[model samples]
Every structure is written in C-alpha cells, then in structure tokens.
Target chain A: MTATMPQAAVGASLSPAAVARIRADFPILQERPHGKPLIFLDSAASSQKPVQVIEAMDDYYRRYHANIHRGIYHISELATEAYEEARSAIARFIGSPCSAECIFVRNATEGINLVAYSWGRSNVRAGDVILLTEMEHHSNLVPWQMLAQEKGARLRFVPVTADGRLDMNRLDTLLDGARLFAFTAVSNTLGTINPVRELCLRARAAGAVSVVDACQAVPRMPVDVTQWQCDFAAFSSHKMLGPTGIGVLWGRKDLLDAMPPFLTGGGMINVVRYDRTTFADVPARFEAGTPAIAEAVGLGAAVAYLTAVGMERVARYEHELAALALEKLRGIGQVVVYGPGIEHRTGVISITVGDIHAHDLASILDREGICVRAGHHCNQPLMEKLGVPATTRASFYLYNTPDEIDALIAGLEKAKRIFKLT
Target chain B: MRPADDLSGMDELYRDFILDHYRNPRNAGTLEAPDASCEDLNPLCGDRIRMDVKLHDGIIEDIRFQGRGCAISQASASLLTETVKGKTVAEVAALGKDDVLANLGIPISAARLKCALLGLSVLKRALKL
Candidate 1:
C-alpha cells in the first residue's frame, strides 16, 4: 500500500518549512478572524480542508457530476469509477484487506449505529454482555446503550484510571462472557491512546467481537486495521482534512457479508421483486442512497494528501506539538490539564484554568481568534468521571504550529486576568 | 502577541459585577423545607441550576439557588436569586428572557443565551411547581 502512494520527501520530523508549505494548502489559514490570525486548534472537532480536497470536490461537481452504479452514460461511468476508486484509496489508507469491506456512511456515528442495528441485532441475544469503556464518545456509548436496552443485553465498562489511562487490570473480568467489545482507539476528551491491538486480541480470545472507534486515531496517527485485527473500525472524513457528510466503516469481510443491510432503498438492491427484494453485497448493501459522491472524491484527495505527507510524520509532529503545549500549560499554575501524560497521549489537550468556566475561557480565546472547543465535547460520561462540568479542548493537527499553542497559552492568561484570577 | 484591544469586548462580557456575582454568589445555598423547588440543566455545558423558593400567600418569601457551571450561568443565577427574592410568584413568573438579558447589561451572544437564561428557566419552573 505504501508503494502505491506517491510519497513526498518527508523528513524524520515535519520541518518548519514542510509545515509552512502544508499550511499554505489550506486557504482558511489565511483568513483573519476578529482581525486576528485564525489559529485553528479544533481539528479533533472537524479539520479544515486543504485546497487539494476542495478542488477535488469542485472538479467532480463541475466536470463529472452524475449518479453512480445505474447510469450507462460516460459521466456516470466516470463518477462511479471515481467513487469506487476513492473507496479503494481509503481502504488502502487504513490497511483493510479489501475495498469491499469499507462502507460509506454520513459519519462515524452512523457507522456505529449501522453495526448496532444490523450486526448487533443478530449476534447479541438477551442477557449477553456488551463491553465498552467509560471514555467512549456519545457516538460509541449511546448506540450500545440503545442496543442493550432493545435486546436486553448488559453493558459493561472498562474504567478509566485516575491519570486518564484505561484500567486494563479489570479487562479480563469485563471481557469474560462478553458478546462484543467496542472502544475508542483514542480518547477524544482525554487524548489517551488505548492499546488497540491488545484489546482486540483479548476480545477475540474472550469470543467477543471487537469494534474500534477510530475517529480520533485515524486522523492523528498511522492506523492499520489489519494490524489491529479488530472486527470493525469507524472514522469520519471531516476530522481528517476531508469534507463532511462522509465517513468509513471498515469491517471484516465475513462479518460485513453476514450482516443484513442497514438501510434499504435504490442502489443497494440486487433484485427487486413485487413483494420482496434481495440486497446488494457488502459495501453496496450498506450504501442505500445516492451516497456522498463529491464528498467521497474529496476524501480520496485527503487520503492522497495525507499519504504524500505521511502519517508517521504527522503523528511525530503532532506529538511534539502536544508536548510543547503540555509544557507551557504546566507553567500556568491555574491551568489543570486533563488526560494522561504526554507519553501516553496525543495532541488533544483538555484543560480548565482556575475556576474559570470552559465556556467563558473559550469566549475569551475566541476573541483572540484562537479556536478551541469548550463544553462536554460529547463525552458527558467522561466529564462526570473527571468531576468537571466541561473542559476547553485544544487539539493539534499537521498544519498547526507551536506559535499557535503559545498564543493559546497567552489567551488563557488573558482570560485569567479578565476574571481577576491573577 | 496581539494587543489586548481584542479583549476589550471580553471586559464588557465579564464585567466586574458579573464576576463578583460569580465569585461570591448571594443566596448561594439551598433552603430547608422549601415550598417549591425545581432543577434544570443547560445541556450544552452541563451547567445545572436548582431553584428553591419559600412561597407564602402566592408570594416568594425567600429564594435561593445552587448551581455549578460557567460564569454567565452562575452569575446569572446569583443575579436572578437577588431579583426574585421577596417578589410575588406571579411577578417572577412574568419575567421573560428579555428581563434576564437586560439584567445582565451586556449583550449576550446566541451561544451563551442558554447560560444567561438558565436561572430564569429554573426559577419559572420552581414557581410553577
């Protein structure tokens, strides 16, 4: 897969020049918010698309805009080819065995819901245990809760340790007799990178299916689904420098083959009958509507861009940024940063300064044109565990710079001064 | 770093009075054996406010609020407690979102509207109960 990608000359680390070039590709970076430079530190929420991705979608719409699969026209054939090629590119990006195993949905939330509705409904019976973690986003947690409630299944959680790592000591007991185990590859709130391969192997040994919420991981680091050996993995394109309205659910070939279709409509049927209809195979069966045509094309461009830049470089650069951020945040006595140590975490940093509300702090930062996400971050359960109403999150990506982080710290200091915390 | 000119807008939003209300909230604790009480949450930030009131002859004799949230929410809650105390339940009920915004003095962005109005919502619910 690496051989197929057009790799650029990437260094052991993303040099300042390399990062500056990457920043130039994103037009949004040029915009001035509140007459200040737009310092986007919210890539974990949704990343800004590069010109490459934007142009890809624009080209698809301008030149070859047509419905896929059914049309026999030239543009239609081209559109279908582009869409399927995007799927293959994404499949290779994630190291999936086959492109057919990749099912495109609206987002990661829809992907999880598809599994809970289709695979979970069939495999999980009453009183079966579904294993989850306390750190799961609402997307991963709510679907299982819905499934458990509907099927009368019991849901168990792997506790988060005090310092925000998963308490793996209780994993054996929790995985015991579990029907399925779904967990995040990275904690969106805590920035804790879970042991994906080990957890998957453990779940397999326990005779339970494994699902990985790769929403945060796929964008930040190198994620090989095959290497993890997880049954299914989901991630969103929007968080990975691609357009919104498209995400991937990479599942095992057998699992996807056996599972019933999630949605039923045109383009997903093999044979339509007056009374009953047969569904299409695997990926096609899951994609029931017209699908996100241009969005998929943009995602492919995003994949190409990331591949050229290299995931290893992105991960290393982001790790450095997170380290820098953690160091600076530590200097601020009022700041209480959440999640594990920098060694155990990625670039996502959640924090609360003094008794300052996350919203108030965020408002102050926004005025400085520093974009950070405040509030529960869709992990209310984790917030409850951390005993904070909300935390202001500053997540980094390949395009972010250390200067932006310094700006964030300065903004935090200003917020403290304004609230008279100084 | 940019000049603090950008933060001038923040000064108005987090004026000294609002911060004062947030830091040393008046009538901060709950009341024992309250005649009416209600709790509500601003789900956006998980900011919660519970309003307890002692009603006598359709009047709010005593009012207190307890909450955990952002400055806008806590300050608004504190300000609301002071405003509604010793007022008729009907008068307090007549207080609308505009009244809360007016009391805050500064213009509230749409994002923080829920935070600013959470106290009023809780108080109205408490009186109704």
Candidate 2:
C-alpha cells in the first residue's frame, strides 16, 4: 500500500476491512440525499464528525454540564477537570512540550487575530516588514494586513511558482528585514505540505517570529512545534472532525506571557480593581469569558481517535487517495488539475474544465449527491495568481474511499456531456 | 453519460436564454465618465458586479456593467441591462428583485439568491435607488 497504484484499483490496495471500519465510525456516511448515497469530497471546508467525537460532546451535555472553575459543587469540579484535560490532550496531540502553551480560541481566524493584536501590536514597529505568501487564506492574510496598516509596518509577499509551490529562490531577500513570518503549514487549495521545520528555523535565524496556520495540516499530518521551533501555530477543531466553536493557538510560553492579552474579562484576569487589572498566566490570560465546554471535550475525543488510528496511517491513506484522484482527474481530457504533483500534495484537488464555471460544476455535482467546494475558497489572492475566476475543489479525509473518486469522475463526465464540452 | 441524469434539472435553473445571456452579455463594459457607478461585491461567495450608468434628462441614456463572477451573476447583469435600457430613473428605481427573478424564468435557491440579485444590487447602488 506504500507504493502508488493505478487509480482504478487503488481501493483494493489498502486493507478494505480496516477502511470500512474507519468509515463506519462516521454516521453521516449513511446519509442519502435525493435518494442517492452521499459522496462527501469537501473535507477541507469542514470534516464530518465521527461517533466518538459526537458521544463525547453528548456525554458532557447530558451529565456534568456546569460552568468550569469557581464552583465548589461536584459537577463544576468534573467540568473543570474535563476542560483542563482536553487542553492537555491537544497539547500532547500536537507534540508540544507543555500544555500551558495551548490556548482555546473560537476558530483559526480568532487564533490568528489573537496573535496579530496581542503579540503583533506590541512587537511590530514602524517601517518593519511582515512577509507572507500569496496562497494564504483570508484568515491568515487579513489579520496581518490590518496589523501592518495599524503599526505602520510594510508587508511583503513570497510568490508561489506556477506549479503551485513556494518560490525558494528568493527566500533570503524575503527574510531580510522581516519582523515576522506567517505562513500555512499546508495550503488548503494546492495541498502543498510545506517544510515547517526548515521554514521556522530560517525565520528564527532572521530574528523573526514564525506563525504556522496549521488549520489544514494538524489533522491530516503530524505536527511537532518543538521540532519546528515556530513561535506560534493556529488550527480549528471543526476542520479536524471536532465540533465547531473551538480552535487552538499554540505559542512559546515566553512569547505568550510577555504579550498582552487579546480580550479582557473576568476568567482571564488575576487581579482586577476599579483602576487596572492584571492578567492570569499563559493559557488562562488568553482564554477570556466562558469557553465552548462541550466543543473542547469533543475536540479532545477527536484527538484521541486520531492518535489511536495513528497520524502516519491517516497521512498514508490520504496520500493514496490524492494520488488516485490526480491520476483519474488527469485522465479526463481538458480537465486541468491545479497543484503540485501528487507526491508533494495531499487529498485536496482543485480543478477546472474548458469554459465551465466552478459554481456551475459544483451545482451539477450536487445534483449527483457529490459534495465539492466552489468559488475562491477564501483564497482570492491565490485565485488571482492562478488566473482563474474560481476553482472546483474536492478534498478528502480518512473516511473517504476510491469508489467516491470514481463517482466524482463519472459526475464530471456527466457535466461535460451536459455542457457539450466534449 | 446516462440520459436520466441529463441536464434537464439543471436546465430548469440555468435556462438556455440565461446561458445565452451569460455567454454573450450585453453592455458588458464601462460607461466612460458616467453619471453614476457603484461596485457591489458579495463577501460570502465573492461574486462582484459594477454598474455604470450614463443619465440624460433624468433618463438612462446608456448603461454598462463590468466584473467577473458566476454565470448567474453575469447573466443576471446582462438581463438587468436589457430590462432597464432607455427606462427613466424613476421607472428603474421602482423595479425590484421580483422583476429580475420573473424575467430569469427560474427558481433560485436561497444561497444563490445573492448571485441572482447581485446585478440589481449594483444597479440600485449606482442609481441610489
């Protein structure tokens, strides 16, 4: 199963029984829309949750539903324990040395904003340059733009090659006067798995703090912050098969402790008088107000499930899926697949056919109960760089199968016929 | 390809006339130094349209729209241009979203309602209606 197989027979290469067991864990797979079986290929937008993650959240709400901390009651103590345990679970999941470095925010957008407002506002000075890449999602791009405008800092872009990869030729000049470097661990559209450790080290050597937007990377692959030595990383729980409303922001404890808190409230403070307030330590200082209790518990369960399945196996499975998809997609005439070679990519596929609008293609797929994302995918700059109005994207996860890829090919053929494209 | 899953259902939404309008949009350019022009972008889906109108004696003497988006948006803009040509400012102002949908001859989903009406939105903004 390690070696790539032809697209038509890739399904049987892996252990079918094991893949079936994994697929059975997710209840949403049984859903039939328009009296047809669902073939979800839009995991990049948000992944479907498994029963284990669902049960964990349900159990939390059914029993031990209480405000965490500041309660002498038994349920409160249990709730607090569960929340803190989830934090530790996530920290261990990402291979962070300490749990205190993990702070729960709303989503990846908020996680980036937290660093932009707190760490960025304090450290970024006038005339400083913040280097970013062209393929960044709006979440990672906009916050830095705002920070640059507010702090009178300059912004530079690292252009992506036509083959949908970072241009490594001009890295030295891009790093030259950059105060901070923010980049994605894995491009959501192109599925470019970046060299996180090397990029982080380069930024560190240049006296710049690196922020890794791992919203697409953490679930699909293993991420070790200690090895990467990046200053900060952000990811969303929902995108990784956990419930929405919970995201993680991991930073070096020293950087987090020194930076000002993002939001001010009762829970995040240590001493609050009428005059001024002192914040709590690392994680607590950033986690203001009552957080998403059940969502955190669900995310903890998701991490546990992934750990049990093993990230390496998950990554391998996704690679197979991606390779097969690329082969099949390329075989279809006039279908241009956007991204690196399958060897350097994940299961995310962005493609376009001759004169067929992305939205129209998505609609046609939806009619066949195949789910795919259309439009700019929150990467308008990337769309501009690619010279396409929009692209139809189909992303995969562990629960996906080769049969679904076949259905996608069939669907595209049908769309081509309908549009008189062939 | 199976005939049962043919584009008959899609034809209900994207009629031939709509596709024709999208393929050959009328007035798909800028009215130079127009009396009014406004660009409206749908933040959620990223569909954008800018309507430029040249007014004379409180009447739209010429109008054009420019932007790239989905078929529905571009076709709707083309259809809007066809519907409002030579009409008085008050007459165009009195027209509403229902008029465009009626002329489109399709049932629009809630998610695509924005795309269908994006042209109208830009026109309304351009005329301050």
Best by lDDT: 1
Give per-residue CA lDDT, model 2, range A172-260, as digits (tens): 68999999999999999898888889889999888999999999999888788998899999999998989999999999998998999
> What is the C-alpha DockQ of each candidate?
0.67, 0.52
Cα miss at A327, model 2 (Å)? 0.7
How many steric overlaps are in each model, in order?
0, 0
Chain B TM-scores of the candidates: 0.93, 0.93
Q: Per-residue lDDT of A1-422 in model 1, one digit per residue for the tens? A: 12222123123768899999999999999999888999999999999999999999999999999999879899999999999999999999999989999999999999999999999999999999999999999999999999999999999999999999999999999999999999999999999999999999999999999999999999989999999999999999999999999999999999999999888999899999899999889889999989999999999999999999999999888888888888888899788999998778999999989999999999999889999999999999889889998999999999999899889988998998888786
Best by DockQ: 1
- Give the CAPRI rating of model 2: medium
The Cα RMSD in angstroms, rounded to one decimal, for candidate 1 relative to the true structure is: 3.9
Model 1, B87-112: lDDT tens per residue? 88778878998999989998799999
> Which residue pairs of candidate 1 clash?
none
> Residue by residue across B1-129, what tens digits does model 2's lDDT show?
466446648767776787788778999999769999999898776778999999999999999998777778889999899889899999988888799899788888777888898898889888998
Model no. 1, DockQ: 0.67
lDDT of 1: 0.92
Docking class of 1: medium
Residue A359 shift from truth in candidate 2, angstroms:
1.3
